[model samples]
Target: MDLNWYWYIGLGVLGGGVVGWVINAAVQKARKSSAEVLINKMREEASKEAEHIQREAKVTAKSEILKLREECEHELKERRREQQNVEKRLSQREEALERKNDSLDGKLKNLERQEKEIELLRERLNNRENELQQSISKQIDELERVAQLDRETARQMLLEKLKNEVKNESGLLVRDLLEEAKQKAEKESRRILTYAIQRYASDCTYERTTATIPLPNDEMKGRIIGREGRNIRALEAATGVNILIDDTPEAVVISCFDPVRKEVARQLMERLIGDGRIHPTRIEELAKKIAKEVEDDVYSAGESAVLETGIQGVSPQVIKLLGRLKFRYSFSQNVLQHSLETAYFMGIIAAELGLDEQKAKRIGLFHDIGKAVDHEVEGSHAQIGADILRKHNEAKDVIQAVAAHHGEVEPVSLYDVLINACDTLSASRPGARSETTELYLKRLEQLESIAHDFAGVESCFALQAGREVRVVVTPEKISEGEAQMLAKDICQRIEKEMNYPGQIKVTIIRETRSVEYAK
Candidate 1:
């Protein structure tokens, strides 16, 4: 039992020793681990601080670099500005120097030219003085020898001679100029008139105020005369025409001073005869229908003329008036035909004169349009036509041409002059106008009597169908100047006393016959 107790005690002691050693070692290990943890923590803190310091240094250095760069840029910019200012000043100074140099050069050139001019003047003055002295001495000697007169007398004689010569020469020059101008004017007038006449081929026809309507049978005349002349009276009243149902076989005669009325009457008679109607009502109805038809025909005629002449923008009223000319007659010449001839003449002349040909044709067409209503209107045809054109908003030039075509107003354009000439030409052509034998003979006799009435007129002959009168004057009675005056006087007298279609030319001939026997 004792051995077992001792063994138990030893085991206990040994166990206690082991436990203490383990507890010590465990404590040592814990201490070592905590120490290592502290050192590692300190190392991590040092690394964080070093990194933060490095970042601050970098920020500070970057700020310093940015500030230095800005300063350097500022200095560089200032230096560049200074350099630019230096360059600008230098350029300005250079330009100023150039301007001063140019001014000096100009002044020097002026001085040089002035000096040269003064030198030349001095030399020329000296030469001229010597020449004047020589010339004066020579002129005195020569004048005394040649003229045998004093200086004053020679001067007066020379002045008188020059004055006489100038006077004679100037008179001759004036006379020659006047003659040339007169000849040129005459030639141009003749050329323009002749050229217009030559270019246009006018188909002239005699227009009659009376129209004869053919009847289908003798019964038609009675129908036209109608029940106690009621039909004839109705037509005459409705159309303002005189319907004469004479004993003529199968025909009716319609007469009126107004051609439009006559035309309407003629058409009415034809329709009534064709329809075999003999009542006044039918006569009136047909008259109205024919009148409207005549109006349409008139418009058609006017339009045809406008188109043929290539004229545009004519008012409807003016065109209607132009159409009335279709049936009108002027001294046996168809007025429309006369107008066409005048228009063509105007176009030809206007083209030659480099004017607007279409405008000229328009003026010609409207020139005689007033004649259509002249019998009804109070004013002259030219003035009335001008008023019509003005009302229609025609151009100023066209209106003036219309007003001045007949010399009622002063011509304002070449077109107006051409229209007047064309009008005269159309009226004056051969076979253009017809006059009775009695009237024609009377006109010729009147022309001759007027020429004979003038003093110094020995014999007068009418030529060119009374267009010209040649008066032979005695040379002893009338001088050349008197002959011209006598011609003008006769022309004026004829114009005032006579009513003629065309101008009459008065020519006075004076002959001084020097008859000597040839040995």
Candidate 2:
């Protein structure tokens, strides 16, 4: 019974084992099928997604193509438009060229015709000269036979007698006419000049361009110099002037090319020295205040000048510019005072000449107005003055006179000439101007030397205080055109070789004299 029980147990165990293996295999198979189905379903989904992706890509590519096509089409259109424009311009240029060619041809034809006409006229003149020569020869032969002398002797005797008589009469006539006219002109000019000078005698005032500030002590210079020179630098930066604090004991020197800056710095220095508190901020503040004060004083000065001159209806801008001349100097002579003197002289001379006195005075007052802004403006004072006058709506005559005062423009009226004379008179007066004699003589010599460099120049004079240079040229050597060219060359040389203050007038005088003595 134990054996049979063992056998059955063994078989049961084996059967159970087989059954478990089969179950496990079936489970594995079932799982594998489910996994395959899942994988297939995933593949289908993936395929669908890929198709969707492909569709999106195609759509994107098509849109991109459309954009690119539009862009290309726009670019092509632009190119076509540009080509059309270029062609149009080229055609227009061609037409213009054709028109120019036609005009040139017409001009050429006209010139040819004129040349032919000139040739014909020349031929006719030659023929007429031949006929006249024949007639003269026949008359001469007849005269010789009648006089019973050779042609040479008879002609010489007659010519000598006629020359003697004509020479004496012509010389006397020319001498008398020239002497009378010269005397009258001299007398009138002297009278006018004397009357004008007598009527308007002005006080001579000269200005020195020195800006030396006297400090109380040398210790004060250290304060002005500040820590590491910030004080001096601030003063320089504020006033646009150099504050030179060298070994100058108890004195500070200010240097600048601009007079306005020098004056401003001078006032600032005085105030700072009085205040005894020197700092950068204080410097800037004081500089501004002093600048404003100076400006006001300048304007007042201009107003005072205008009132003194009795000028009416003056433009505020012009008056302001005129006031700036208070600090300006020409050859150490105060420009403002010089202008006042010039105005007075102009008025007096105008009265004597029976001219408009107010107008004359107006021109004189504004003649040097350009000097006020010349530092800030380009061009000569005369041209700048004219432009300023034009901007101010000044009278055309007055503007012309101001421009011509320095011969920058041709004189259009008597005022222009009068301004020159009065300007010279004012400047040339004794003690009116103080120039370095050595430097003045050197400049004049240099100017003359510059003119002498040009060929055909007989002599050159620096007149009008070196404002004008008169060059006398040999008429035989320099023609009229060459004289003008020589003047220009000399002027160019002067401009290149030397530094001058004002515009120099180069007058080229070319004259010939035919002189004879009657015996």
Q: Specify the highest-TM-score model's number.
A: 1
| lDDT value, residue 373 of candidate 1 | 85
Per-model TM-score versus the true fold: 0.61, 0.56
- For candidate 2, what is the TM-score? 0.56
What stretches of model 2 exceed 4 Å from their correct place?
A: 1-180, 443-519
- lDDT string for model 1 (401-421, tens) is 989987778787788888887
Which residue pairs does candidate 2 place in steric collision? none
RMSD of each: 13.3, 24.3
Give, for candidate 1, the lowest lDDT window spanning 10 residues. Answer: 167-176
Clashes of 2: 0
- Among these predictions, the greatest lDDT belongs to 2
